[model samples]
Target: MPETSLPVFIAPPLRLPVRTIGRRTFDFSRQVAVMAVVNRTPDSFFDQGRTFALDAAVQAAVDAAEAGADWVDIGGVPFAPGPELSAADELDRVLPVVQALAAVSDVVISVDTFRPEVAAAVIEAGAGVVNDTTGLHDPRLADVVADSGATLVVTHSLAAPRRPHPRPHYDDVAREVADLLARRVDVALAHGVREDQIIVDPGHDLNKTTVHTLELTRRLGEVTALGHPVLAAVSNKDFVGESLDRAKPDRLAGSLAAAVASVFLGARIVRMHDARAAVDAARMVEAILGWRRPVHAVHNVS
Candidate 1:
């Protein structure tokens, strides 16, 4: 009997179209876009007050672009334990950087804040995407997105009480987060945000322990299965640092590993700090796994 050659299984390269804060469309199928972090606050965990000066801020954005970041995410306040900056204050802190970046480069300028006023102001200044750490809480936020025609990254987080309170709870973290995200999508839809303009991040370090973060990473396929592109933000996060026994600055390698793993598990966009390293690693993974659609023909790769 003659032995027949078994057919090799090659998954098609996953291509996602993200309409960015730049008001232009990018093809993620071509490469994993790197999002450089630019914190304008005095208390951001890693680079707090690192760019208080406008020159420093502009330089940071320029450096991110030079370092191979496909986009630059500028935030006014620290996400850690601190007082949230007011909308006007936030606008003042970040709009200059956004305007500067928009003037110099065509790179995507993402404003990381939940305040609708701030989001509107920054987008008006030429920022493209609204990365809301608060998962669609302010109903008015949806209106801002619709009005500005900017893409939205709606990440998951537990609802906080009005009064100062203790940490929230999640009995089944994955299911609860997924449910909350599903509701968030419904909320956005109700408020007039288009489906294609939405991105869902499972809120990697926020309101989650190391075990929870690990579980979410393993189940990212489940999150992406919800029918929206996934943005995995595993850059220098507490869980990654704590898991690897490394300091914040030393967490780049760990973050890169986590980003690679998350993308392999079904993340479409990776929000990261080390843009060049992350983008190169993701491209290599895509190459090694043969995860790309043939440009000339769809059936050619298979």
Candidate 2:
């Protein structure tokens, strides 16, 4: 096998102080976090609304938490190019799930949205994090997060909500992504969001081609160098499918590989559809890298 070229620029050691999200606090530096995806939308790229019903969505969140996911990201709208969803409709879709999960689960709750109204509603409903995939397209989203004392995940996406960016071009995909995330972090900070309450995602496949996403993964340390916890949402994305020449249902291996690679490159959190597999992969990686202690070391320890 050919040797891969990883980033040579050494970032400072990951030093993510504990961040409070609602009643939960996470110290991201010690181990990788697996964030399970729970989409309540009928048109989500993967799962295709299997969890769209309120009962199913709530059950999915509970299952993810029980499967060892540290976080559950519930989304009302799909990020793909599609008809826009009104804030009211989005709220109607996600609020019940968030409320249910928050009431019963100690697992951190994140609402994936870009609208300030939706963010505010979910935060009020006990969501600990507001995941803005629009890259802060609406600045007021940050305001809502700040006011509610919720964590904010600012992703780097150039397109407007539910809009497509055709033929996207970037001089340096990783650098540009890092820069955009930095700017978004600044925006969040200026909006009164605490620095520790921020997480950054490079938005793999969000306005990026397969090659772009691969390059971003290759150099994800640049984004992690920004001093905030990096969230890699590499689960069953189109880029992984395109890279491995596999369909969405068949991309589990590719997604897990990409997710592990992201963690190796310094991503502190991984968002994934298969929570159990992802949690195992993350724990294995952390253990191999000496960041996590083995749950029980036995046979070879003699």
Model 2, which residues run further than 4 Å from truth?
Answer: 1-12
User: lDDT of each structure?
Assistant: 0.78, 0.88
Which residue window of length 10 is worst by lDDT in model 1?
A: 6-15
Best by TM-score: 2
| Tens-digit per-residue lDDT, 1-302, candidate 2 | 23334343322255555676667677665568899999999999999889999999999999999999999999999989998788899999999999999889889999999999988888888888999999999999988988888899999999899988999999999999999899988999999988878888999999999999999999888888888888999999999898888988999899999998888788888999999999999889867666667788797879
TM-scores of the candidates are: 0.87, 0.94
Question: For candidate 1, lDDT tens digit of each residue in 1-302?
Answer: 23333222211123335445474566554346678888887877787587877788889899888886778999887655566556788788899999989998988889998888888888888988999987877878889998778889989876441223245466877787888898998899888898877889999978788888888888776787676777888999988988989998899889999998887776767888776787677767765555553335556667
